[model samples]
Target: MPFAHAVMHEENGVFGISFPDFPGCTTGADSEEEAIRKADEVLTFHVAGMLEDGEVLPVRRSLKELLSDPEAKEGLAKGVLFLARYELPRKSVRINISMDETLIEAIDRAAEHANQSRSGFLADAARQRIRDLLKAE
Candidate 1:
């Protein structure tokens, strides 16, 4: 299990939560409680997406250090702050999808050449696409 820090900034009745360790990882809600709950799911998805994209996980700063930061401390004054924990999934489930036969063969060959399972190869491709899409925004 790994842990991450989250800071919630309240604005106009909305709670916007963000992770200092992960610059782009964030979620929000109307209440502090909902913001915390959303942070858990966002953290889980973010860590898994990073892993899938073959990106390095960031080393988390201690709570004391996070609290010491100017921006984080500013967030403290503006609203609330907290920590969220996430664990990688212990098991994987098989899935099915329909595709063109030619594409399927190409994907299978690429997976074999990459020394990866078909699922793993496809997962990596999807994650990379997501990264590209986000970066273009």
Candidate 2:
């Protein structure tokens, strides 16, 4: 996983978020909290798309590095900064684990309801939990 600096600007009650390192990658929300949350999703998907297309991911810039750029300076003047987590998807590997039968049954039901394989459902749930934990910090 990598972290990118996300710039957040607000206009007309809507908060807009963008990543300087990843051009054309952006998202927005109705509040600051929502903007932060959406930034994570947008950054992750944007990087994932880039990877899928065989595009090279840029090396993330430090806050100092970003502040040195004139364009970044101007954007910062109008907004604020935060780090958005970027987890690159990798090749899947098979694994085996033991769990309570009832828990496994419930997971299967939830996966079916969501139209996702059990592996996908578990992966998404884990990612969301990681994001929530990171936000709490």
Candidate 3:
């Protein structure tokens, strides 16, 4: 999970949002609630673009550290603080794996029934197993 501190405020009746750690990343809405929701969508897209560009995502900073920045200090002076959390997945990669022929055939049949490729089916299964194991821990 990665998070960015956000500041929400209104000027001329339009709500504005800002992410201190992400200087140029900003968005707004007509209401505070919509502003918060839009922030999540915007941040997710921003982070995805950063990833595509081979740039590291901005690290979250403490409120104190954020305030130390002149722009953040000025931008958030009259704003309410909130956090935007994101769980982003990396780009998929193909990998070689060994499985029993019988199991592979079964998997292929299951994948066809589910209307998914064998690789896609296996990836979905692996992801679900990971989630289940983590929950059991």
Query: lDDT of each structure?
Result: 0.80, 0.84, 0.80
Which stretches in model 2 have alpha-carbon errors above 4 Å? 93-137
Q: Candidate 1 residues 13-67, lDDT tens each?
A: 9878888888888887787887787778778778997886799999988878877
Worst 10 residues of 3 by lDDT: 128-137
11-93: candidate 2 lDDT, tens digit per residue: 99988998888888888778899888878877887787687569999998877888899988888889888888977888888
Q: Per-residue lDDT for 29-121 in model 3, tens only? A: 887877887787677666765774599887788889888988888877889889987668677888888999999999999999999999878
TM-score of 2: 0.65
Specify the poorest-scoring 10-residue window by lDDT in model 2: 128-137
| TM-score, structure 3 vs. true | 0.63
All candidates' TM-scores? 0.64, 0.65, 0.63
Segments in model 1 whose C-alpha atoms lie over 4 Å from true places: 95-137
Candidate 1 vs candidate 2, TM-score winner: 2
How many clashes (backbone atoms < 3 Å, residues ≥3 apart in a chain or on different chains) does model 1 have?
Answer: 0
lDDT: which is higher, 2 or 3?
2
The alpha-carbon lDDT assigned to residue 117 of candidate 1 equals 88
